[model samples]
Target chain A: MDYFFIIDFVQSLADGLLFGTTYALIGIGFTLIFGVMRKLNLAYGAAALAGTYVGLGLFLTFNAPPFVVFLASAIGAGLIGLVVYYCCFRFTPEAHPMASLLASVGMLLFLEEMMTHVSHGMPHPYPSVLSGATLELGDIWIRGDLLFVFGICVVAMALLFWLLYRTPLGLATRAVSQQPRAAQLCGIDSARVNALTFVIAGVLGGTAGAMTAAAVGILSPIIATGLTVKGLIVVVIGGLGSIPGAIIGGLLVGAAENIFLLLRGVTERDIYVMLLLFLFLTLRPGGLFGSAATRD
Target chain B: MKLKSLITAGMISASALALSSAAFAADKTVRIVGFGASSGVVGIFGQNSGAAMSAAFEKINAEGGITLADGSKAMIETEYYDDRCNAEEGISVLRRIASTDALVAIGPTCSNVAEPLFGILQAKVDDAGDTGLQFPVFTDVAIKGGLAGISEWVFRNTPSEAKMYDDLFAWIRETYPDAKTIYGGVEEDFAHSRFTWYSVMKTAAEAHGFELVGEAQWLLNDTNFSNQARGMRRAEPDVVAISAHPFTSCGMLREMARQKIQPKVLVGLTSSSSLETLSGCANEAQGIIIPTSFAPVNDEAKAAAEAVAAKGGALDLHSAAAWENAMILRDVINAAGIEGTPDTLEADRRKIRDGLAALTTAHGLLGENKRMPDGEAVKPYVFVHAQGNAWEVVHNPGS
Candidate 1:
């Protein structure tokens, strides 16, 4: 019995770690936007989901291939990101940062309501490239779809890292993110850079949304708010504006959720997760990778 | 002189035609208002119910409407409001409806909302002390059992889940004699799911000689079910009963499949027998049985299904009741001699409530449905299994 219990515990951890990849992707989007603009995009998850809806519409209307669906989702989310930037972040005086935050919150509600209306709040079957595939390692099994999500997320993150480090555009973005006044004095277009950053984050968010939908094998408007909350939690846990922190935070949260659920039943599981969040907020506000000087 | 006479005759004829058309346009209408959660996860139910009501009213109107007390024709006109499945919103909407010319109202689709909405209705029929709203409400979708007993003014067209599950387990015992052990799963966050799983499914299974092996719980919006699946696997029960909506049910089922926990018999909640379940996880949900009141079994049911489909809504168990409720409204109005005028709004509501209470049996799409004294219905049901992206009726308890 003890051996079986241990095996179940291990399996739960494995399952959550794999599923956490989607969260990592979402967290990366939030972190990137915050990293560049020094402002939070509360509508990030909704915008991403809207992009997924666009992909779903095409898939339903034209029987589009999975590859095309992913591409459409990314492009759709990127476009929505630009709109979100203009509506929520761009016009607000940088003096009152709360205005942009409030505007993004409003955008979140609007997107959620709009999507619910369009979909009639019905859950749709998201097409999966690898449906119900599994990998077995003696008493433990890994979900095939989640493994695929992890792979895609890893590649996306690698590409993002490469872009931020190697390219000239990347250099301009880093300079703007680190010191906007300095970059502007050096003739860098801060506004254009910020817009590009949003576009990039939106693209990443779209991919994350699609991955999440595919991993769960279902999509519904109800998921928008929950995803937003989860993404926010990940960002907070991972260290605000820290990409690596988001990844680690996502995995930790995912694994911790499953482990707690197993140890304590479902009713009490979330309480523990919330307690963990509170602990982090109180004890380690700077997060695992963030510096104390970077505190918001 | 002939041309002048002809033109005079044409003008006189046109004036008469216009007068007749104006009189026809002035025909009185009986207003029935519907309010439910029309913009949330369960919005489909409200949208579908509203569409079914509209289709039903359209058909009634096309058949020359209903007969009023004075032998005048009165068309049924409906307006659907969005309560968003909130208790406060439902109460406010009901209050607004009471002030209107609406003879009757239908739903606040969620039970939590319906509970509070019913509380605000007049407790006793003619209690002068109670200032509760004196209105009649015919519920279609809020399927939590015994909600109608809250107020005499409230009536439910929704099915009696208690009786359905009792019958379902009794039938399961006879058919699957080898299913001796049962495992339970529920959406803990939802009142209906939790109550049905613990009070109904567990009791019925145990009563039918099935030993309780284990149980698990989850939330409606929970995405991962690995831990729950592991628990279900450990028990290895012969039957796995899950009381959850389509979303969580599909998620749990898929997780169960991944963990390779194959139970011999799978029983699902009443709400899980929906298109969402099929669309979300048909392959995983294959062979899982659920008892439901609505199926495209007979000609009337098929027509109701088509009518609702024509209105861009699928008539499932809950929405099908809306179609029946519309027909009931017409019959009650005719039998109770309702005038359906603005001056008689309060009297009309009282008459409708009396008519609903007087019903012993009502005509349903399938057949006659028994109307209990407490405003609940003993609806006809069939056991269906998920098969190839569709629910195929396995056993018709009615037949």
Candidate 2:
């Protein structure tokens, strides 16, 4: 009996860790977009679903290798991001953050609708990028997919950090994000920075979408809202503009929810997660990370 | 003066003919309405079912419709209503049709949406107290067995899950006696999943001498599967069963993968034999076996599935049923030979219904045979195992 609970606790912990990878990835997508624009992207998760649809479409069409399908899906979703930027943000009054936020939500719905129309609400089977092999580490069974996903998330976040902090484009983007008028005065076209930010963020969203679908091996429109909510929760809990915070929050939430469910039933799983979010909202809205997003 | 009278007579005769035809047209038209989930991901089933029904009608028209005892034939005229798979919307749509002249109605695809809506419909169909609406409803895809609440007028053409699972567990006991513990989870919110996991599975497992180590529920829109996956892992059953629609099922499987929880055998719901399952967890779902009515292994079935895909529709067990049902319905119409005009519409409808109920077995375009009784059919689903990224027929039910 004692051994059973031990197995139960450890199993739940491992399961939570695996899901944390996906949560972290989704959080990163939201954080990447929000960090530069100072605008919350409701469509970030939708963009991911759109990408999974694209990837599946390509896979069905060509029966090509999985890598090719994943790449195509990523590119397709990136294109959708360009459309979001052009239609929702580019034409909007630059100073109106509310317009940008609402526009992203509209774009989310539009993309979700397009996916529904194309597939007629049938889920597309996504092929995983990594082989779903397992390694039995004594009492611990490590899923190769989860490990790969976590690795990918870590690598993606690191690369993004490097791009944002080390590159000239990153410097320009930072300057624009901090002070758009001042950046413009310095001959840095804020429009270009914003456009690039949208495209890059879209790429991240697409990758997250493709990877998670591939990990699970399916995609559907309903996931749009879940991903959006999880992503937002991670962003908020991690401190809006903090990349590391988003990653940390994603993993934290993922583990916490699983642990909660193991102790309680599934009905109360979300309640605990929401409470955790509430705790953050009430106590430290700035999150564990110092750099928080706040509208002027 | 005679010439003027003759011309006047001709003009009056033409007008009289046109007016008489218009007046009698409404009575002659036998209107039937179909409601379905036409908006979301699962909407493809409804869409294809509509197409198949139309095709069936076309074939009937071509071969001369239901022939009455009087040698008269009347064609089936159908109007489709998009329910969007919402119970509220389905209720409104059903109500709209209930008030109209639509004699017999079919569908509101989602079983989750079907429960309460069917209740509202039951009152209409089964009010012996003369208080409820009077309409005969035969749902196509709603698989709940408790549908006969109000009256026997509510019929279903769906294969009973209870019977299907019973046979399956019996077969499993006979085949794999050594496989002991069964651990699995289902989408709790969906009625299909809930009943499948709790009722049908528990009953079947107990009867078949297998013990259920654990059962868990994952919500439909849930993206993470840590708790459920962990439960399955903790149970450490020899076999792990998943009773979920494609999306959430795959999500749980990925979580299983993340936790590195692998059982000797993996089992899945019949509905999981779709493009969604293959795409979502292709690698993780490998070797996970399921029984399904439709497989594109046969030439004709393969061609039909491809044709649907070409038309941007994914053909699975459900869609395959649409195709097979269409062919059978067409055959019934051709066999009945009901002859023309509005007066014989009731006779034609009754004939179609009877013809469908009487069919014991139908030759399917696919290799599997569909066994029918009182309108519903049990599909001959083979034991299909997930290999890499696709469901391959591991055991041919043809045996």
TM-score of each: 0.94, 0.81
The per-prediction i-RMS, to one decimal, reads 1.4, 2.7
Show the lowest summed lDDT stretch of 10 residues, model 2 chain B.
B24-33
Best by TM-score: 1
lDDT of each: 0.88, 0.71
**Model 2 lDDT per residue over A27-95, tens place:** 876776676676777887898778777778888887877778777777777777777888877888867
Residue B80, model 1: lDDT of 96
Model 1: per-residue lDDT, tens digit, B1-399? 999999999999999999897687457788887889877878888998899999999999999888889887878889999998888999999999888888999887898899889999998888999999899999999988888999999999998888888998899899988889999999999888988898888988888889998889998888888788888888999999999988888888887987789998999999888887887788899999999999999998999899899999898888899899999989989999987778887888899999999999999987888999999999998999999989999999878
**What TM-score, to 2 decimals, does candidate 1 have?**
0.94
Question: Model 2 off-target regions past 4 Å?
Answer: A1-22, A55-73, A94-98, A125-130, A133-137, A290-296, B1-29, B67-72, B99-101, B122-133, B150-153, B222-239, B251-267, B273-399
Q: What DockQ does each candidate score versus the true complex, computed on alpha carbons? A: 0.62, 0.42
lDDT of 2 by residue, B1-399 (tens): 999999999999999998886564423334555778767767766786666555545555566554434544445577668887788888888889877656567776777677777666434323466554445556666665555443434555565577766777777777787888888688887777777777876687677878888888778887667557766776788778788888788788777876678887777887787766776667768888777667787788777766666655656666565556555655665686544345555565556555655667776755435544444555566778888767788776457
Clashing pairs in 1: none
TM-score per candidate for chain A alone? 0.97, 0.92
TM-score of 2: 0.81
